[model samples]
Target: MSSTASTATSPLGSGAPPGTERRWLTLAVLSVSLLLVGLDTTVLNVALPTLVSELGASTSQLQWIVDSYLLMSGSLVLFCGALADRLGRKWVFMAGLALFTAASVAAAYAGSVTALVVARGAMGVGEALIMPATLAIIGHVFPQGAERTKAIGIWSAAVGVGTVIGPMVGGWLLSGFWWGSVFLINLPIGLAGLAAAAFLVPNSRAREARRLDWSGAMLSVAAVASVLWAVIEGPDRGWTSSAVLLSFAAGALLLGAFVTWQRRSAAPMLPLRIFRHRALAVGDVLILAGAFALIGTLFVVVQYLQFVLDYSAGQTGLRLGPAALALLVAGPLAGVLLPRVGLRTVAAAGLALLLASAAVLGTTSPGDGYGRVLTAMVLLGAGAGFVITSTSDAIVGSLPDRDLGVGSATNTASIQLGAATGVAVSGSLLSDHYRSALAADPHSSDLPPDLLSSAQESLGTALAVARHLPGEAGPTFADAARGAFVDGLGPAMTTGVGVTALGIVAALVFAPSRTASAPRDKDAS
Candidate 1:
């Protein structure tokens, strides 16, 4: 085949470019689909307490319910991106939308923690397919320049918007209906996106037919799953236990093997050469760190508001509005500034803000009230907005046209992996510290062994046990539980500060000083 024949075809049929109106409309449809994917990332966060009461979920189970979706999506996105490149972006996107909608129904009616977790994993599969396709389609539809940058900024903002809005939506739903309503709400949105996408979204795929790297795909998934399993289960199962140790060892081996295979494969799932792009490398790290801070903080704060401060789900959602608003505002603003200011300044500033946010949150005490937390949320939101928008633009813009599918997938995988890690690491630290504090408390010594064991499982369980106790003992035990939870939040926030500080340093040192020049389409060379 001629080199010219090996480039991506125009998304619009018959080589007629889509009109500006159609291009923006396509962006709208893609953004809404992306919104659903992003919404799922945090929608379940507010519903976690309800799940504890409704499904009798342990802390580990709760982490699993959230991380399972993240894990599957993060791990499989590359493979799905490859499929979309070969088969059709539109086809994979529609299929994913349909599957995600169906999985939402299954998740809504799930009767047990195990069932709900399974349903969530299924949803993750759908997300893996949808996330990359949307970005790749955007790459196909929009030319690389200011126009594409603006579109990508809007696309990036949809993620932040979805994530921030999730708690509010879930809170409103949980206020009137069962927890299942959180999942069920996706039905109308998903169905509408699916139908609109069929007509509005144009089809595109790689002109060159390359062999898919199945071996690399499997190794990547297994490695991630093993590492995440160890992280999530380590607190409950004992970090030094044979199973945890084995998982860590296996993950390391699988990761090394994956790297070796990719280097040797005829058609690697992820081309190692891409990381040579400084902006792309730095962008992925910054994006990952930003996501870790934002999502991890949300995981802990939502629980803190509800479990400690006695806020209802609706109230908790309302309180979180400042962060969402800040993010909504900052995202577009970052886009407008990127071409003028350069990525280095914008990205470093964003990470600096996140570090400051984490530092503030680390000092939080039960008596600090909502004011302190509100300040932290605003910083977190604005920081994440700048980081996600600027870095997403950097990552996507750095790639050659041929690499857009897998490149976008890798970009998004960084996000999901970071968010998943945030939940696992934050929850583990919280659980381990809470358990230790509870064990050390004098109030815990008076409880029965079985009750003590249950209390050690989670703050919610501890509070429940305290409620059933007699007289002053009940209130004292509850106070201890609340104190322990507050103590646990410190370590998680401290970790975030450390991570953000590192990201700030990296961004300042490595990120490019100027906006991307133009699309070179290196494949043409």
Candidate 2:
């Protein structure tokens, strides 16, 4: 639908209206929406094993369970963001909440993996709408100052809170109920967000309401989805496979076309000039690097806890509390310090700490004490908290008010891509190294080729296979597999160390010394 051009008399005027004090209340309501989106990202992780058993889901199907949501959300975020700017942020946000709520109900009642995947894709559409709107509303409500910084900080903290509680809540629910309980929990929160947002979030839109960039939006979605599809499929299909290579080639061409179209278009959805700003450019890089490390670590470590340490889902969730607590404290603290210290200093410090954590994690072994791992996890969390908050402040604070929706979408998309790349790279490395370790073992020579192939596929499969082996062979095979898995972690984490090291240099060289002023467009909110 075409948006009406906003005028001074329109409720869509850019300024915070007379009741500016209600901004905090608006923030609270917006955060509720954000929390639900963030929680869904991780909550289903702990239930994957259950899903596999109950639904008889294959490996590819399991991957789809997660990727469907990310692919849709990440690909369409830019388009949805522009929709918010044109139509109205409040209208888009409420529509998103209603869609998300309905999708959650469908997901909870899904009878098969195919149905669940469809529901997840629907949820992603809702999430794309909600994410950019929340950030844009915060930018409008807080204006430019310490208050804006703090509000962004709170938003960052809410994500951290969601990350921590997702597994714990999933575990608790799964203990007594079925796997669907996790998705069912989102229902009430979505309803609450819809109700509160109507009363709290003010209607606002770009004053000019430029024509929609339909071609650019389609190309952007195609480029992002193609690249992400390659990343998700690359490890399993072999990086050099024809399909993977073709996907990468398609993504590159589409991306080039997108940039060219944006430069030439009369009205662009994302202005190419924004990348010229040091803060926006560097902040995005930092956010991407932090997400790569954080998600990659969680991907491997959760398996280590469950398969290697023999911890149950509940135990693994509980063990992650220290890291969550550290993140909870560090997010707000980083925001408070951003204006006092420069972005360069704050971001550099965060990267340095993250590099240290990666180095420590690389040194872990199968027999290492829990205390050491916990310490490393906490350090990782603290470093991530600092980087995420500071980078978000830099990105949002640097953009013009009119660009807020698409700009926020850009930030969110970078995060989703970083996460996809991290898991794929780390998983591939772990698989390669573990198989190599097993092949070189003298004991592995006794196993049949088929059993060996099964063991090489995944740690879970190896453990399952070991249990059925003859007598002493079972324990011996289990020990060798666990040891090989630990050996693989070292190489996997080495990649993280390199990624974070690059982030440190980027922060020092490219990030602005101080937060830049918001853009000076006449209609800027």
Candidate 3:
């Protein structure tokens, strides 16, 4: 039960000798898996319009396309992570990759919205398996502390690369091909990974006596999925509807039960005891908040670029180039800086930058130039980069030496949760405010009755139709829709500012300044 950080500084490896060509080959396989997952998260966004046009997906179906993936991926990751620990990392990861690849093919060929939704959900299940399995393997393979940090830094950089490149790749595919091409893109990547992994990666078996928390896992999934569903459906169902209220009630009750059950269960899916450490708790909270703000806004921004600014898919991809470049530069710098500045200082700087970036974004209106957009995007990338890299280090460092699987599970789950919640929260705000704004506008009369009904739908869906309107009515409709979209962005930014500000205060009040060295005597188990 030695402190993970202290022992982690030394070689605590579970695999082959460091610097072997085989080791890097193993990393390459895992990196591809990571790239696919990250790419899939934002990739389909540029293709959403194409999806709607080709498949005739309604507003609710469009939301489902996105939300289904997040819900399953986010909610099931902890269970999947633990399952890998009890099983084997490489096998589970390979399985996840295979399943994900197959699902992509299915999604690509899906004729109906329902089939795509189901395929995407299946893809999420695969992603849940891959993410934690990869992290756990990193813990196993890179024994030496500095090498592990470097390895994970590369992993982190890919995450940034994935975030940046997803849009570009999706856009490129969509411009020449179709919406389904985005899903098809993953097939080659997955096949290459499978080929590499079979030769390069060493398998690690789960220790015996690790208990499965089936009931807790079910409840956790039910709770998170229900909550997300409620938020996504609130517009269609009416915010005050009986079903929405019931979903909320059920989610809250189940989550509460899950927490209570964790306190009593001998084996918990998520160990609440981990949060007793200040560094781990604060780091996790900031990671969650940062993930939400970054992901949620990205969803909205692509719509803004395409529907409001009239950028083509390829053009939209190019517009976002600055954010990716900023992250590529910032990620390595974070790896070098985090250990020196210490977690608290590094995290605070990140949160402050995030607050400033989000605040600036709150001011973005129609006709705002690319220069202003790039300025805010850079800050957002840097801030999110710090939180993700340093905080992941901190979370992993907090675990005991033997429970790297559990540690990875915790970290992975937190991120997914943050991502899901970010989409849910901001998406809810975006749709609600957009609808309200359009409904209240005096210019509503100018739009055809059917078109006006469409405008009151989800912000992204509304924006798409406005951009595609018939005749001279198109320009005015686009203008009104862009105003509502901006109207939504301001509130979303305000929410981000408030959330990040709270994170800053939380770090000051709670995060520890001690070296990341894990304490041996304090290991609870």
Candidate 4:
């Protein structure tokens, strides 16, 4: 169970260890893949307003544009991971990269909201294939211990780099080109990654062949899709609507079935017994919470800066620089500290920072300048960096050698599901609040019925309508819309505060005090 024993027994250990340079080069290539995945996560955020104007997308439709990719990627990753274990990691990864590149072109040229959403979902399929393989490869290339931890830290930082770069790049593209330009940017990056992967990346898989769990895969995909559908549609459909209620019911039942199937299956996609490791279980939960808060806040804040504060997309992306910078510094630092300190201490501190970030952001108002928001963004980024890096290490470190593929998939799935849910839940709260506030505003009384209906759809729609209104009425209506958006931002961020607080509690109660010296058995229970 020690690092020495793990390395000696590993399937990859049969040959001479890869040279230091080759290992690092392989990591760089894999990092590029992660960078692309991370970039897509937020690139669309700054483009949401543009999509509304160009495609006539409603609030729910915009959420779908974002969540569609996440839902598919999150749901299918487990299957892809198992397939990688059965087939070959390198082949699956290359195939995924090609598919993702093709999907990017489709997304870029999409003419309708539905087309874009579907294209994004296709991209997610490729993403599901790429993500787990990246991490699982790292597990094979680097032995367990400090080396592996450092590799993962750097690999994880690529995602942070991508997260920050996405908006800046997208904003710059939007300044001169059409909204589709954002998706187009991925074409060259994907191609370059494919080339690098072909030559530089090494192929590895589980030594033992396992049967694929088709039923479990189906149940998970349906459950997650149903839940996301309900959450995204609830605001517009009314929470009590039969469709929303039925979707939620179906999701719950499917989830229960999935658990039962996993428990009984001969070769399970995810071994339920792995959760017996306190560190692994708690780490997964914290990662989910961290992503939920981080992605959810970004979803709303980008809109707030552009709509309420009247910043251009480029300017808004620039303002987000502080968070990115903070994350860049915090991620590697967390990795260094994990061995010296302990998981509970590091994770709790990170969650506390997140809690503070959410509290500060929750107090933001339209009149407030960027200073308060800047402070919160920095905290959010740093908190996320520490939490994600440390927790990712914990998850990868706790798993036995054979579970690396599925375990890595589990980690990635938590992130995708968290991000998807964050967008759905936070967007829903924002829409509900925005609609309520706009309806109550005195400006609503003056608008004609048709115009009022359009305005109530979203802040972007309202502002578009205001542009055509006569003189002062135009300015007044726009101001009212901005105010409503700010009102919605408060509740969305407050929910983040609550989630982070719970994460803090969970970390303190369940996370291991120190990193284990050896990996736990997969069948620990």
Of models 1 and 3, which has the larger lDDT?
Answer: 1
For all predicted structures, in order, the TM-scores are 0.95, 0.91, 0.91, 0.95
User: What is the per-residue lDDT of model 2 for residues 288-348, given as tens digits with 9 covering 90 to 100?
Assistant: 8887777667666777777788877777777777777888888999998999997998888
What tens-digit string does per-residue lDDT give for candidate 1 at 1-525?
Answer: 232333334343342333323788899999998888888999999999999889999999999999999989998898888888888888999999999999999999999999999999999999999988888888777777888889999999999889988888889889999999999989999999989998889777776635788998899889999999999899999999999999999999999999999999888888888788778888889899988888888899899988998899999988888888999999999999999898999988888888888788778887888998899889988998899999989988887767777888888889999989988898899899999998999998989999999988888888899999999999999999999999998898887888888888888888888756435342211
* Model 4 C-alpha lDDT versus the unseen true structure: 0.85
Minimum summed lDDT over a 10-residue window in model 4 is located at 516-525
Per-model lDDT: 0.87, 0.79, 0.75, 0.85
Q: Which stretches of candidate 1 lie over 4 Å from their true place?
A: 1-21, 518-525
> Candidate 3 on 139-229: residue-level lDDT in tens?
6666545666667777777766786678888888888887888999888989989988888776764444258799888998999988888
Give the candidates in order of lDDT, highest first.
Answer: 1, 4, 2, 3
For candidate 2, give the lDDT of residue 224: 71
Q: Pick the candidate with the highest lDDT.
A: 1
Cα displacement (angstroms), candidate 3, residue 371, comes to 2.1
**Candidate 2 vs candidate 4, lDDT winner:** 4
lDDT tens per residue, model 4, 61-90: 999999999998999998888888777778
Angstrom error of the Cα, residue 501, model 3: value is 1.8
* Runs in model 4 lying further than 4 Å from the true structure: 1-21, 517-525
